[model samples]
Target chain A: MSKNYSDLNLIVRSLLPENQETPISFLPEDHLQTDLFFRRNHFTYPSLTNSSYWLPIVGAVHTPILFSFKDLVQMPSHTVKVVLECAGNKRNLFKPKVFGEQWEKGALSMGRWKGVSLKTLLNVTGLKHDATEVVAEGYDYGNRTDIDHTFSYMRSLPIEKALHPDTIIAYAYNDKPIPFKHGFPLRLIVPQWYAMASVKWIKQIRIINKKFHGPFQSIDYVYYPQKESDAGAYPVTYNRVNSIIQQPLNREVLDTGLHIIKGIAWTGKGTISKVELSVDHGETWIRAVIDRPYNANYEWINWSYEWEISKKGEYTLMAKATDSFNRTQPPEAMWNRKGYGYNAIDTVVIKIE
Target chain B: MSKNYSDLNLIVRSLLPENQETPISFLPEDHLQTDLFFRRNHFTYPSLTNSSYWLPIVGAVHTPILFSFKDLVQMPSHTVKVVLECAGNKRNLFKPKVFGEQWEKGALSMGRWKGVSLKTLLNVTGLKHDATEVVAEGYDYGNRTDIDHTFSYMRSLPIEKALHPDTIIAYAYNDKPIPFKHGFPLRLIVPQWYAMASVKWIKQIRIINKKFHGPFQSIDYVYYPQKESDAGAYPVTYNRVNSIIQQPLNREVLDTGLHIIKGIAWTGKGTISKVELSVDHGETWIRAVIDRPYNANYEWINWSYEWEISKKGEYTLMAKATDSFNRTQPPEAMWNRKGYGYNAIDTVVIKIE
Candidate 1:
């Protein structure tokens, strides 16, 4: 099959600067520009133009159902302002540098996704009692170097994560039909884990008794600290507490005076409990004002720090975040072979002159 | 035509950490392992299994010559230890996060390249008086979205840069024949410019009387700031003064005592004049000891700082470099659409207990 690769360059070109802190900045008033949303696809985008689309449910279930997209839309729909980041976001920062698409911080984006809770969808299928895992498969298939067999993009989550209340089978993004590059007809949105767990262009869901061993699940997105050893490799999950400077951009030269440094902090595990800014490097940190309270568990919160620069020289600025669980952004992420989940404290060097 | 893409994953796996400062750290003793050397190829690697190889010299030359590799070897040869970094090495750190292969710090590697100086090679062919530019073309060709025509990978440099004494037509790396993925028969080594100017699998050199307009020369690698306009875009050139932390890895936990923080620093414009370290973020800085004298213009020198920590707390550490021209690493590199030449001071966070 001739597959059309998504124009990744266009996706990158459409992104607002990472310092902007909000993708909604580019959203137009009349329409939710689907193209502006950051997208990550494992395979070429599949062409689906049929008026009626069906999602197949297979594996450990007694009654496999082919639910139409129209049916999925009619099911109880919930909207979420979820922040989805490719597991490989900030992968380029890994010490040895990992393989896969070398995404920078732009691999993350926030979108208003409207869909039915995966739990509600699962209730229709009636999972077998022995099921321990649910494997979601996308229609796109391709040959990847890491695996010997050609396969479709597939990933699985433990039954618990799959059934989480926030996990959804998204039908629309930003109040519009999901764009083709972003899994058109249907896509799974795993709220807590990195985006890879959220299969795109989903065609099949298989509830299995044992753990899934698909290529994307076992070989590709794994975190192997000791490059060659798969023995210690584990599936990457959950977003780490992280923050990004949105204003007074990295090397932005500032007049020697008062300026407010602003940014956004987020975590998938819990609410952002505190954000600290260090303008004098890391020796001393001042608590930044979190602009908004943690209203949603999946969205980011904006924060700002006021600094009065009295000297004329270069300065290193840094930001660190701690989640409600006392999980703070580490100075360094554990070195993994795939360079996944790098949530080290963010630093920006700014000049005050 | 068949094209063999370099297994980038394998190359990344083969690289020692950037802190190691040398790619050959993992090499075996018996042979100079060229494959282990870090590689960055714009297109698929070309095959040149023929025993005899010829390099074509064209454009603006009165006597265009097809010099055989054998003839080139007879000329005076020089070996230089050069540290080559991708222009986009730290592109991931750029504020807006430009598109391309998001390279981390590992995009840089040091190598002993042996070959004849490009100036000496150019002397054989009489240059036309009006010649102002030299275009180098590699055998690899590919389809790129930015350009309309399918073309070979080509780039141009001003005649002055092309004739620099350090510029060479390299045939060997680490005293061994260049590997297939690393431009097997011959490659251009532009010492001062980022590695993109040092084209691999080189086949032809054209001395043009005017500026070159190839896709790579005019568009692909250009630094287009603001994303919307190319009017201010300029071809990327010259490596910026930069440094990296080699020890006390990011987020590394230290035992309450004395520890040595070490790293390497270099610049393409001039020798590294000073390296400063800030253990307490950026409040106060201490000059680090440059371990070696600045003996070579193209190689990096090691530096280290001593720290005595008695308290249990998290600390942010950063390193800044200044070059001989009194040019110091900026708090950030100028923002460009391609995200090239980011030379911000490097920082690492560590915890002490």
Candidate 2:
């Protein structure tokens, strides 16, 4: 196989930017292996040819300081299992199409991120009281086909989220130093938000007094109605409460018998409180058995249901998840211009012969 | 730049399938140059290493026959200027997101297609009276990421359209033999329909007496509601009355002076009858001067308006096209599952300083 060919069942969305979707069917248990993790790069992979990497913290800070990769990894380390989903994941499943990479349900993956809390770095830099947002800019830069100019992938976090203890300057994934594709030297891990909040390949960090109006911030990733102007647009944040059916792949054929319908559920604001499965196209719902010790705040929880079917025909399966924040995956996602946060009821059809 | 790189003003949507959008801004005169035309390929380009290319006509036909490429080209030929558009054109500009390629306005191009009328071919083959749809299967076949099985790019046209004199087995584009990327050997050029109806890389032509259920026919291009089932789905056809603003690109800066706002408009059912320009976000409208010789039924017509703006401020420009069938481009497109047939008012924002 060619080197560009990923053998781990990855779906290559675009070759130039190298965006790959994880095969979520294989991710039922532990955090996805580093190699199997989804890859989402806005531009070509940023070249890290520097002899030493230094993350500079500047702008609207009392004492701006640069942290070498050594300095970051040497700090008191912390680890958390966080689910990072691309804001545009499940885009193709939406009703009215929006402009973007038509991502599938697998444009997401979970990992154990280990690094120093972002709050620690902010405190060390002594952020000015006027600082409203902290911007993390990556080294990757290129011309996006949608727009006219070259762009560097940059996303800013509100002051409160940046100071949260769980938001980390992650330098490690799954107990090892982070792989290059997942942001090697250092990347931010905003636990409760969509993966866009976790800007990868940290190059520079800036604390700004006003809202950051960068393209990745002000133009793209914003939720707006189908209007001519940005009249009622807002930045995309938390992940929507969602569930995915893993087993009985769409149109799978099998003999009429007992089957275990397996899946995963997650939320950004809180833990998944409930997950329900409907084999009759949402006509009747059955609560799936969520795995025990389900107090995972930033981690996705696996769920399963047993079904005994005697009918020899086709059946439609749907899965819906409810989060502790009282948000439930909708039967149809609300239309947005950018096709973000598609948490519609997960569904698949199968046949029994 | 490498061999895969196209220096022409084209936007590469995907590399493997080689889908590129024509730089439509440069298309203001005669039919687009064959080299600059847009490309929409569902699979990799078929390798045509065969010493002799033959188009096989079979199924539900009294006289099934094979026509060599030379044989078809040598027959009495006809030429028509047709606007071929991807069904998903302007998809990203739609509201509530749908699945499939999030294409922009450039996913279309026009050219003078020269070929034998499909009616001539059907007459020679003697299609049976019961033949319902003519299925044109392309030589390209590959596994689509959205579906479970490998599929050949195939679509069916109702027998009425199949026998229409305007629908031709096109062998040449703009008087020259069709480019390899545009289907060199033979391609079906169905006028007054979206490019999906114009199957390229023609390999086999089958007359079937039943509704064709190929993946491209039944699954991908069908327009459906956001519901779970295909209960209200229908195949997409005909280009919606649409217009594109070719001047004053979005976010362009201009001096306070008189300017010619030029654009192009087209429709599938009839010739463009009227073109309107709205510089004040559709609050007020001005009729544009449609270029003369506007009776080209299958061709897009260019229109221009002389705008004298003395104000030093930002302006929003919008264009709408009205076809002879009384169909006018809507301010907002009606949403569908596949994001096909987006005919919303075209808008571009520019600053006059």
Candidate 3:
């Protein structure tokens, strides 16, 4: 699901110099790193923690089972390198004007998502054929919970993603139980898509024959294409091909000699196979060395290329990533009513004297 | 758009009495008046005052326009009646085995939304033509604000809505400037739709021609048909033919003779033309009298019907509304992946022994 500011008129009251339009690849270390909650337009983090957490299943499922923290702790865990890309990852790419966090590129991050397979847990509970959809609710309260809004933090995955052996109900990340900020006790981790599908602090897993329809499932995360036609209005999926020039974005120009063009590449579906760097405005493309492949699922891979600038006048650096599926980053992303899955290749310019 | 919670699995923490579903319709006196938010969900009301506020215009906009309380209050203002309805207003209707708020209607409300028109303000300032979408960000500081998430209160509307004449950049409600509890200083009051569009404590408005793709817009407010087509999905809009029987849901039995079946009917489009009551499931219908029409566009209108029940068994009283355009409520709503626009002819069971 994605977040869009539909009913708001923002006026910049006061912004620190840095909060202004200074571009970079990743979110600055000092800046706040928050989740992209659609219902809530601001970055929100969990302030409290439930000492115990679990993935409870009910409805058409065989027997209702609540997998507690202890049970999750005992389960076999695997670490998968995946990129948690907010559906609106590159919202900043749109030129002239755009609504949303000027999410230049940082919205997409590669992390070792640590969790247990949901397939394993459902198998342990005994699967039910009648279950057509698996409704998963999050631990976080809905944005306007205080306002009597009934929507809980929830969405449904077809039985397919639920049954995917790789789709894990993760309890740990980077070899440890995730910090409270990243869905500590238990989270459903689905690689290859945005972070929303990986419901954090998951408490319930409903197996239902009927399609799930609630606020979080129907309205919040879905995206409309820019074009009015049905062809463009597909629900966002698969991170698009996008790469960023990480090193310098009009930052202070320390003696510009042999500059190392460094950046990150990611795709929504498969592993990024190649990352090509372009200087002189896509006029020339040089193959950047791909870092070791992250897990086969949905995560980002780092890539870098060395540029020898004998004498630099002005340089525009761009990076494009190709996923295993062979989809390369488009120069201009497909226009969508909702700016989602924006994996267009990113370009950064540097003026060198 | 809206928030979808299909995937969420909430344990029945505490169950309301089965027969104690909140009445669907009630007098203004019965608008579920609550001085404080329910504690079950720990959420605080956002500070709407300008001293505690800031608005930033980030993407695609000609120039990012940031505002403080001083700036917003400084802009021009207008008055309009906006009826805000949470997407989950009739969530409780998904009975039998539905997992949601189980809201017995009542989630809808009409209020004077006051705000400055973003387009007017931007036009005065000159937004770029490329700016097609507007993201309205809010200052809703919730428990989960620290994660790398998007803002808590956010929604994206097409620039069309932002520029509409009726759309206002509001700083007041009902001639009085807002109180902190009610989006102080300013809030966006979008006419003709549910209240979710009236984002409270708004902070920033980003403009971009590109789609404002985020979890909220894509996954949340979107509706999918029961059938998946090769094409794409549909967007949920307008309140459908909906009404609630104001009094005597399950508590007391009406004495035989004359009783008033009072309720309210509303739609996203035109005015309420006729409200009919059905005493026998839907076998027969009678016209119910509307008290008076709300002058604003399509805000909810109050209505009541006098029924002389000479004889009664298990009386199933139903009500349906027709709009000014002659759109009538259907007996059954079209089935979709998300149960949106469920304006099906309502059935209210009343017994007179």
Going through the candidates in order, the fraction of native interface contacts each one reproduces equals: 0.00, 0.00, 0.00
Best by DockQ: 2
- Residue B38 local lDDT, model 1: 48
**Order of candidates by lDDT, top first?**
2, 1, 3
Q: Which parts of model 1 are misplaced by more than 4 Å?
A: A1-33, B1-353
Q: Can you write out model 3's per-residue Cα lDDT over A94-173, one digit (the tens) per residue?
A: 54223444454545445566667888778777777777888887756634321335455777888987888778877766
Higher DockQ: candidate 1 or 2? Answer: 2
Tell me chain A's TM-score in each of the predictions: 0.89, 0.95, 0.81
TM-score: which candidate is best?
2
All candidates' lDDT scores?
A: 0.73, 0.82, 0.60
Alpha-carbon interface RMSD for all candidates, in angstroms: 16.3, 11.6, 24.5
Best by lDDT: 2
Show pairs that collide, candidate 2: A96-B96, A96-B97, A96-B98, A97-B97, A97-B98, A98-B97
Model 1 lDDT at residue A47: 60
The Cα error of candidate 2 at residue A276, in Å, is 1.0
Instruction: Predict model 3's lDDT versus the native.
Output: 0.60
User: What is the TM-score of each predicted model, taking all chains together?
Assistant: 0.51, 0.54, 0.45
